[model samples]
Target: MHLLLVGPPGAGKGTQAKRLAKKYSIPHVATGDIFREAIKNETPLGKKAKEYIDQGKLVPDEVTVGMVEERLSRDDCQKGIILDGFPRSVDQANALSDILQDLELALDAVVNIDVGDEEVINRLSGRRVCSECGASFHVEFNPPQDAGVCDECGGELYQRDDDNPETIKERLVVYSEQTSPLIEYYQERDLLLVIDGETTPEQVFERIEKELDALE
Candidate 1:
C-alpha cells in the first residue's frame, strides 16, 4: 500500500516502516535515503540539496518535493511505497498530495505512532551506540553485558550528543509545533492510523499491523 509513517523522533517510525514495507513488498522511500542516493549519483537536484546541506541549512521544500516526485515516478514504486520522514508540515503534505495526484497514486494511510514526550526522552536518552561497529543498545530495554562497552566488538559505547534528555525535549517541542497540524491534516482526510508507540517495538508493530489489516 502507499503509506506514510509519521511520529516524533524516538517513536520507532523507522522500525515499523521497515516491517510494513517488507510485509507489503513495497519500497520504503525514506527522505534521508533519497537525498544520499541522489547526492551519491550527483544528480542535479542532489547537487542542489548538497549545497544547502553542506552549509548546514535545511533544503528547500521545492527540492525535497522534486526528489520525492522523482522517486515515486520510478518503475519500482509503481506497486506502492512506504514513505518515511517527508511532509513534516501541512504545506509539505499539500505538496505531496499534488505530487501523488500527478502520479495517479493515493496514500492508503498515514500511520502516526503516538508516544509521549517523557517516554520519548526516556527511550532516546538511554540509547548507546558502539563507536567501532555501530551496534545499538539501550540501558533499560537492552543493556550491554558490560557497562559502556559493546558486546559484539568489545568497542567503547557512546551516547550521541543529541540523545541527551535536554536535546530530546527540545526536539519534541519542535516536533509538536510542526507536526500537530500535519497530523490533523491527514486526520481530516480520514487516512490517519494512530497507534500507541509507548510499548516494545514488537508490540508497536503488532498494533500497526492490526490497523493496516483493518484498512484492508
Candidate 2:
C-alpha cells in the first residue's frame, strides 16, 4: 500500500488517507503533520522551514525532500506508508522516485482525488475551527450545536484566514498550476488513480480501495 495521495484544497484527502492507511495497516505520513511536529520541536530543518512558512512562501525543496526521506527511513515505513500532501511539484515527484529507489522500494499507486473548483470553494469557505481545541466544523456538512461556538469545548469557532473564499480560490489556482502536470507524470507511469472526491468519505474510500485491489 505504498501510495502517494494527491488532491486540491478541500478535497478531503487527509480524512481518506487515514482510513486507507488503517485498512492497509500502514502509517499515514502526512507532510503537514510532519512539518508541525518538527516546527514544534524546533529542529534545525524546522527552523529553516519556519522562515519560509511564516513568510507565506513554499519551503525549499531540499528541506522538504530531506524531511520526507528521513521519515521514509523510519521503522514503521518498512511495511508500507501512505504519503499525503507531498510531491507538490514535478521536481518533488522526481526526487521521490530517486529516494524510493535508494531505499529499495517502489510506489504502488498515486491516488488523485478529483473535485471541481467551485465545490472546493464552497467546501472550504464554510469551514471553521475551534480557537481553543482546534476541532474542525463545516457549516454545511458538520455545523456546531451553536453558531460561533465549539460543540466539544465550548470555545469560539471562527473561520480560518486561509479558509475564506478568496484565499481558497487562490489556493486552488496554485494547486492546479503545480499539481496538474504531476498527474500526467504519474499517469504516464500507469500509477495514477483518479477518483471522484465530491462523494461521501466512505464512497471515496470504496473507490480508492477498489482501485488498489486491482493493483494487487
Candidate 3:
C-alpha cells in the first residue's frame, strides 16, 4: 500500500493518512515527522534542513529529497509506506520517481482529496486552539462549551494568526499554484485518485478505500 496522500490545507489529509496507514499496517511516513526526527537525532541531512528552517526558508530540494530517500530506504518501508507532505511540486515528484526507481518500488496510488477554496477558507478560518493544552476546536463544527474558552483546561481559545481568513485565502492560492501541475502529473501516469473532501471523514475514507480496492 505504497501511497502518496495529497490535499490542500484543512482537507483532512492527515487524518486519512493515519487511517490508511493503520488499515494497511504500514508506517505513515510524513515528511514533517521525519524532518523533526532527523533534526532531533542530528543527522547530516537534518542539520542542513535545520539551517534552512531556522532561517525561515524552504529547505532546498536536495536536502528534502535526501531526507525522503533516507526514510524510504528504511527496513520498515520494505513492505510499503504511506507518504504524506513530500513532493509538493512536480520537480519533487520527479525526484521521488527517481528515488522509487532506485529502491525498485513504485507508488500504488496517489490519493488527492479535493475541496473548494471557499470550503477550505471556512474550515481553517473557523478553527480555534487552546493556548494551554493546544486542543483544537472549530467555531461551527466543534465549538467549546463557552465561547473563546477551552472546555477541558479552562484556557483561552484563540485563532492562530495563520488561520485568519485573509491568510487562509493566500495559502489556498499558493496551494493551487503549487499542486495543480503535480495533480496533473499523477493523472497523466494514471495513478491519481481524487476523492471528495467535503464529506464526513468516514465517508471520505470510504471513497478512498473503494478507489484503492479497485486498484488492488
Model 1, 93-172: lDDT tens per residue? 99999999998999999999999888899999999999999898999999999999999999999999999999998888
lDDT preference between candidates 1 and 3, better one: 3
For model 2, residues 93-155, the per-residue Cα lDDT tens digits are: 999999999999999999999999999999999999999999999999999989999999999
In terms of lDDT, the poorest run of 10 residues in model 1 is 173-182
Q: How well does candidate 2 match the true structure, expressed as C-alpha RMSD?
A: 1.2
RMSD of each: 1.7, 1.2, 1.9
Report the lDDT tens digits of candidate 3 across residue range 2-27. Answer: 99999899998888999998999999
> Against the true structure, whose lDDT is highest?
3
What overall lDDT, based on C-alpha atoms, would model 1 receive against the true structure?
Answer: 0.92
TM-scores for all candidates: the values are 0.92, 0.95, 0.92
Give each model's whole-structure lDDT: 0.92, 0.92, 0.93
Task: State model 2's lDDT.
Answer: 0.92
The local lDDT score (0 to 100) that residue 172 gets in candidate 3 is 84
* Residue 110 lDDT, candidate 1, scale 0-100: 92
Give residue 5's error in model 2 in angstroms: 0.8
CA lDDT, candidate 2, residue 176 = 86
